[model samples]
Target: MIIAVVDGMGGGIGAQIVSSLRDELPTYIDIYALGTNSIATSAMMKSHANKGATGENAIVTSSRKANIIVAPISAVMPNSMMGEVTCKISEAISDSEALKILLPIMPENISLVGLENKPLSLLIKDTIKVIKKEFNIK
Candidate 1:
């Protein structure tokens, strides 16, 4: 299975997701690091993503093959990530057939209802559960 972890700016979030996925998921699952910039891509690579790409074209192209897309909620919102996420990137992600698992964390300017303010680690653990359930991983 191909899992794409998208992030921008400092790429810290993407790095964390990649690292956790690596630790918690089976090694056979491919992790793709889709970053809005090279810095973000490099950071995620250090976390051991199988492959990495940067910028809008890279994201749009790479997103197609992802069976599941994991990212901050901002990845689907254009002009998000301090304007690092472009309209094309958001459109591609939204249009892809991949099941999306977006973290609720976002800038204070954006608010999502029906989600409690949970610790990031807990949220990440929750995400891991979703993946395990979906893939029926033991």
Candidate 2:
């Protein structure tokens, strides 16, 4: 299966997700690291993503082909990631048919009501649980 992990800024979150997925999922599954910048892409690549790409076009294109797209909630918000995520990028991701597994992390100006505000590590664990359930992983 093709799984895309999208991120911007420092890419720390993406790296964590990639690392966890790499450890938990079968090696046959392909992990694509899609980043808004080279720095972010590099960070995720270091976490052992099978492939990595950067910039709007790469992200927009990969989002469509991925079976699953994992990212922060801000990925669907225009001008997010301190402006790294453009309107087109957000639109493409939001419009994709892929199953989206979004972390509850939001931009500073946006707030999610009743969110438990868990740390990133905990959120990532929850993400893995959801993916395993969907894919029927042991």
Candidate 3:
């Protein structure tokens, strides 16, 4: 399966997701790191993504190939990520058929209704659980 982890700016979140997924999933699963910039992609690549792509076009094109997309909730919000997430990127991610698992990173002014705040590690664990459940792994 192809799991795409998308991030922008410093790529800390993508790096964490890629690292966790790499440690937990079997090697047969492919992890694609999609970043808004080269720095972001490089960070995720260091975490051992099978492949990576950067920039707006790359994000839009590669997103189609992913079976699962892991990213911050800001990825689907245009003009988010301090304006790094362009309209095309937002559109592609939002439009993709992939099962998107977004970290509940409450944006500056927005808030979730009922979702309790959790550390990134816990959220990533939840994401891993879903992946395992999907493939019936253990």
Candidate 4:
């Protein structure tokens, strides 16, 4: 399956997610690192994503092809990541048919009530658990 891990800014969150997936999931599953900038893309690539792409167009294009999209909650919000996430990027991701596995982590401007503010490492671990459950992987 094609899993797209989207991120922006320093891409630290995306890198952690990719790294955890690489360790837990089978290598045959394709991991696409979709970044809002070159630096973000490079960071995720270092985590061993199967493929990497940068910019709005790359994210928009790959959103259609991905079977699952893993990202921070801010990824679906326009003007997020200190404006790294554009309206088109958010639109393309939100409108995609892929199952979105969004980590409940975002900037101060947005908040999801009732969700605990977990640490980044815990959030990444939770993300992997969700993916494994969805894919029925042990």
User: Which residue ranges in model 2 land beyond 4 Å of their true spot?
Assistant: none
For candidate 4, report its TM-score.
Answer: 0.96
Tens-place lDDT digits, model 1, residues 1-138: 999999999899999999999999999999999999999999999999999999999999988999999999999999998899999999999999999999998876978889899987888899899999988987
Candidate 2 lDDT over residue span 1-138, tens digit each: 999999999999999999999998999999999999999999999999999999999999999999999999999999999999999999999999999999999888889999898999999999999989998987
2 against 3, candidate with superior lDDT:
2
Model 1 vs. true fold: TM? 0.97
Return the TM-score for each candidate structure. Answer: 0.97, 0.98, 0.97, 0.96
Q: Candidate 2 clashing pairs? A: none
Query: Which candidate leads in TM-score?
Result: 2
Per-residue lDDT tens digits for candidate 4, residues 1-138, read 999999999999899999999998999999999999998899999999999999999999999999999999899999999999999999999999999999988689776789997898998888888888988988
**lDDT score for candidate 2 against the true structure:** 0.95
lDDT of each: 0.93, 0.95, 0.94, 0.93
Off by over 4 Å in 1: none
